[model samples]
Target chain A: MGVLMSAIGFGIVTASILAVSSVGFTLQFSVTNVFNLSFGSVMTGTGFIAYALNTSGVSIWASMAIGALCGGVISVALNWLIFGRFIRHGISRFGMVIVTIATGLICDNTIQAFVGPTFYAYNAQPGKAFNLAGMLLTGQELIIIVIAAVMMTATHVGLKSTRLGAAMRGLSVNASLARACGVPTRRVVAVAWFASGVMAGIGSVALFLDTSTFAATTGSQFLIMVIAAAVLGGVGSAEGAVVGALVVGLATEITAAYWNPELKDVVAFVVLILVLLVRPQGMFSQLSSERTAVG
Target chain B: MSAATQLYLATVSVYICVNVIASWALDIQFGVTGVLNFSFVVFQAAGAYTAAILSLGPSSSSGGFQRYVGGWRLPFPVPIIGAMVVGAVLAGVVGLVSLRRLRSDYQAMVMLVVSVIATIVAESQTGLVNGVAGISLVANPMVSLIHATRQTQIWIFVLFCVFCMALVGVVMYATVYSPFGRVLRAVRENDRAIEALGRNANRHRMQAFVIGGALAGLSGALLVEFIGAWAPNGWFYPETFVFFTAVIVGGRGSLTGVAVGAALVGVGVQQAVEYLPITLNPSVIASLEWIITGILTLVFLWTRPQGLLPERRRRFPTPWRSDAPELAERSAATKGDERG
Candidate 1:
């Protein structure tokens, strides 16, 4: 019972990080409809930015805020410079996917060239562990959970209440219809990218803090799990991302606590593949793809 | 030529052969069939491991250094054949699960996920293929069979690889140019239209997947046998993009083009990078290679989607109605579906 409770605690922390990143991922995907394989690079970039700040004696939280803003700017710049150009060039859907892949490879390798294969860690501390009901969590993990809750609430309210949110949703469902409805297509899309980047920054920092050490490829490595959570909940849905992250986070931690630690990730992947094969539409996704649209 | 130069040439030739086979395998799936097989390197790794385990002595026998399943003391041809079979079977299993009526993008993500799963399992399970350090010191088949000097044995292995390449080439020619090839191309063009004509497009894709898997396995088996090592580091998911770049550069659906592409991209890029005037870090050089590949893909996609040597447009002499003389050239830019 004690083990399970601690596992749940770790799961919550993991879920917190995943929820931030996946929501960022899914939201941009919702607006642009491009599966940004390079989103992980944004996380890595922001993590390093925070690293640079922390190493130079800046406070970690302040660095996080600045790093997040940089992440937003970087993501928006990537769209404006590369993705937008390719889309305007009128590449096929298959071509678009390939183009994004090329973009990601370029980004990842560029980072690799500069950083080499070395691993890095933040200058901040994990602080003291607080035991709450059997689940022991450090100060950092607790802060992360609260931040995730706040971010989720903000996104939920923003999407539900704000005119900008309505325009974004409108664009996701039908771009042409939304344009006809006078939604500023270009502005909303860019805002989505920015928002996604900010979330990526926060998520990557939380993840790095929890994991302790990091590297250039860390974001891409964790990307598969982020993708799994998003896919499990259904692509392009923020609420589903949270649910999916919790499910994945708990399943992985519980599996580790009970079974071989090495196989914990394997269990989460098995669930992903099964869910993908059995239900590609996912649990919470409303827009059925043409392949799954029919009876 | 010096003996060292002679040995170097032979090794390069063997590498060329291995890459050509692998690229053709990828071409059949991605180029001709339009299946986004992002987990391609996994098939090659599977074959390499299969060959290594079959040929190597039992893990507990020689100093008990490495641990893995199925360390049979098999002879020359058996391990290579075993590798191909295992590759096909793995492909079949993966295809059955992923090749359903899902969206193409979704299918691609599944392939990526599968690739990640394979890597995690390989890295985590220490007993399986000796974890990260990998299986090494795999005896070249020629060294054991023929009693000769090391150079002579290596030359013999090179000959065998060339022979295998020729056989695979013949098989590729037969499959791609035949009526079956036409159907496969049709499936890539529009699967819906083929279904309307009473052909199961999904089954056709599965067939391509299995065939590609076997050939990819053969390539890996040959590579491992020559290089004498198999490890998780060599088969990461991003490695698939290298093959995709080869197909795109060489001209998809063209056998000759793809072989030329495989040689140029796989061999030529590394050689070119080596000759750069300024000294640099090894890791930086690796990054440069990828960046160049990424750039090359973008440039080719933008300018010459048909490639330098485009797929030959077959001419059907329609004397009854001389409307069009040859099949239309489908540029990679706008060849297949406009949108998924």
Candidate 2:
């Protein structure tokens, strides 16, 4: 019982990080319809940037801010440059996927070229664990949970209340229609890219806080789970991503705690496969009319 | 040429031949059938392990250094056949689920996940092919039959690889010219129309997938036999992207193009990087190679989507011929039906 409760606690922490990344992923997909495989590399790059700053004696909070700013800039550049060119060339969605994969490879290998294959640790002392109701968590983990909750709430309120958020949602639904309705579709898309990139950057910092050690390929390694969460939740739905992340996180942690640790990663994949098989449209997808064809 | 140089050339030749076979295997699926099989290396790894275990003889009671099933101590031909069979079976199983239901993008993601999961399993399960250490010390087939220096033996192996490549090429050529190939292309272009014509599109895809998987297995078996080892590290997910880039650069649906692309990208660029006189770290060079491959893929995708040699249009009998008009009419009617 104690083990189970602790696993749940760890699961919530992981779920929080996954929610941040997955929400960013879904937001990008919702607005741009690009799938954005390079988001993984962006996350890793920002994490490394944060690590470098922290090691250089900068405060962690400041490093995170700068990392997120860089992430946003780079992500916007990718959208305005590479993806925009592909879209202009009339590349199909599938073609865009291939392009993003290429972009991801380039980004990952570029980082590896500079950093080599070595891992780096964040410059932070381990905090003491706090136990409450038989569940154990560290100070950092508690802070992460609180930040995730606040972010989720803020995003919910922003989307429901703000004009820019309304414009973003409208663009996601129908870009041309949104433009016709006097919404600034292009600006909204740019904002979406920057916002998602910021989310990815912050999420990477949280991930580094949780894991402490990371390598150039760390973000790509976590990519499958982020993709699984976003797709399982409903590709365009942020709230659904949180729900999907919770399920994946709890399942992975519980399996790792009780069963073999190595099998934990496999649990998310199995769930993804099951979800794809049973409900191809995902949990909260609104676009049921679009059927996928092979060509 | 120096003896050492000759030996190196022979080894490189063997690899080139193996890559050609693998490229053709991928061409059949991704090129001809339009199924983006991102987990292609998994099929190859499956074949490699099957061949290794089958030919490695029985394990000890304690299961030797690496634990695996079916230590049959099979002969050369038997292990190769076993590899092909295993590849086909695995493809059939994977295809039944993914090809039948999922969209193309989803299928790609699922296969990627499967590849990652397979690697994790292979790395962690000590009972399966010795975990990360992988299976080594694989005896080369028919080594006893040859009485010559090591260099000469390598040349002989190269000859054998050339023979295998020719055989695979001939088979692939036959498939391309056959009516079945036309139907496969039709399915790729429009599966719904193919379904309307009273044929199962999914079944055709599965057949192509199984055949491609068998060829991939054959390539893996040949590669492992030559290298005398198999490891999880050798068959990473990125390896599949390399093959895809080759197909794209060569020409997806063209067999000859696949050969050319494999030669250029798989053998040429990779080997060229090794011989470059750059004074950089080896890791930097490796990363540069990957970056080059990524750039090549993107360039091809953006500018030359059809590849270096676009697929040649298949010629049919002229309308003056007795049966040509009727066949043409039927095709036109099918197209009209689809558009309507």
Candidate 3:
């Protein structure tokens, strides 16, 4: 019982990180219709940016904010410079995927060359542990969960109320129709990329804090799991991403506690595959229709 | 030539042959069939491991330095054949899981996930393939069989690799230019149209996948037997892209083009980059290789999607009526291709 509760506690923290990143991933994908494989590189870049700031004596949270802003800018720049150019050049959907993957490989290797092959850690401590019932979690973990909750609520409310959010939603549903209805497709897509980058920044920092140490390849490696979570819920739904994160988080943690810890990821992947087998369109997606990439 | 030069040439020849075979396998699946098989390296790794275990003695041999399942002391050709069989069987299993009626991108994602899962499983199961340390010190079969010096054995292995590549090339040519290959290409262009014409598109994909897997296995088997090592690090998911780049640059669906592509991109770029006077660290050089590969792919896609050597477009006879007397010379000019 104690082990299970602790696993759940750990699961919540993981889910918090995953929710941020996967939501960012799914949201941009929904609007742009390009499976941006380089999203993880953005996370790695932000994480390293935060690391530099934190090591330079800035507060970690402040560094996270700055890193997230930088991530947003970088994301926008990538879309503008690379992805947008390829899309405008009349690349096929399959070709677009290869383009993103190539972009990811280039970015990842460039970062790898710059950073060299070494592990890095932030100066911030995880802080003291707090216990509730049989579950125990660090102060940092608790803070992450709180931040995730706030972010989730804000995103939900924003999507429901804000004009920008409405434009994003509109663009995702039907790009041409949304353009006809006067939604600024380019601006909304850029905003989506920015928002996604911000979430990625937050997620990468929290992930690094949880893992305690990381390398250049860490973010890209973790991306497979993030993809699993996003695909499990459905590719384009923000809410479904959150739900998928929770399920994946819980499955991995519980598997670690009960079974082989190293195979915990395998367990989460199995859950994803099972879900996909039963529901090919994912939990929240309707029958997916082929749509040309908009932004 | 000096012994050193001879050894260098032999090693280079072996790698070129292996890469060419692997690229041809990828061309069949991705280039010809349009299946984004992101887990292609897993099949190659499977073949390598199968060859390793089959050629090497039991797990208890050599003071138990490595532990793996099915370490039989098989002779010469048996291990390579075993590798191909295992590769095909593994591909069939993977195809069964991923060849569903899902979206193309979704299918690609599933294959990627499957690849990550395979790596995790291999790393975790220490007893299965001796864990991350990997199986090493695999004996080359020629050392025991041949009554010659080390150099002779190396040359013999290189010759064997060339022979294998030639055999694979002939088989690929027969398969690609055949009527069945036409169906595979049709499936790639439009699966619905093939289905309308009374062919199961998915089944055709599976067949191509299985055949490709077997060829990949053969390449891997030859490679491991020559190199004498098999590890998870060498077969990571990104390794698949090397072959993809070869196909893209060589022209997909063109066997000869892919072979030339495999030689130029797979062997040429890596070797040429190393000769640059910059003299960076080994790791950075490795990173540079990947960056160059990525940039090369992008440039090729932009400048020439048809590649350096494009797939030959087959033309059929457009029968004209005898009434159109003036069009006789024009019809002769638009000659049909020698596809067969």
Cα lDDT computed for each candidate against the true fold: 0.87, 0.85, 0.89
lDDT, candidate 1, equals 0.87
TM-score on alpha carbons, each prediction:
0.95, 0.94, 0.96
Question: How would you encode candidate 1's per-residue C-alpha lDDT over A133-185 as one tens digit per residue?
Answer: 99999998999999999999999999999999999888788887788889888
Q: In model 1, what are the clashing residue pairs, if there are any?
A: none
Docking class of 1: medium
> Candidate 2: lDDT of B329?
68
DockQ of each: 0.57, 0.53, 0.51
* Deviation from native of the Cα of residue A34 in model 2, angstroms: 1.0
Scanning candidate 3 chain A in windows of ten residues, the lowest lDDT window is: A286-295
**Segments of candidate 2 deviating more than 4 angstroms:** A288-295, B61-63, B315-340
Chain B TM-score list for all models: 0.94, 0.91, 0.94
lDDT of 3 by residue, B3-54 (tens): 9999889988999999999999999999999999999999999999999999
Expressed as tens digits, the lDDT of each residue in B83-121 for candidate 1 is: 999999999999998898777877888899899889889
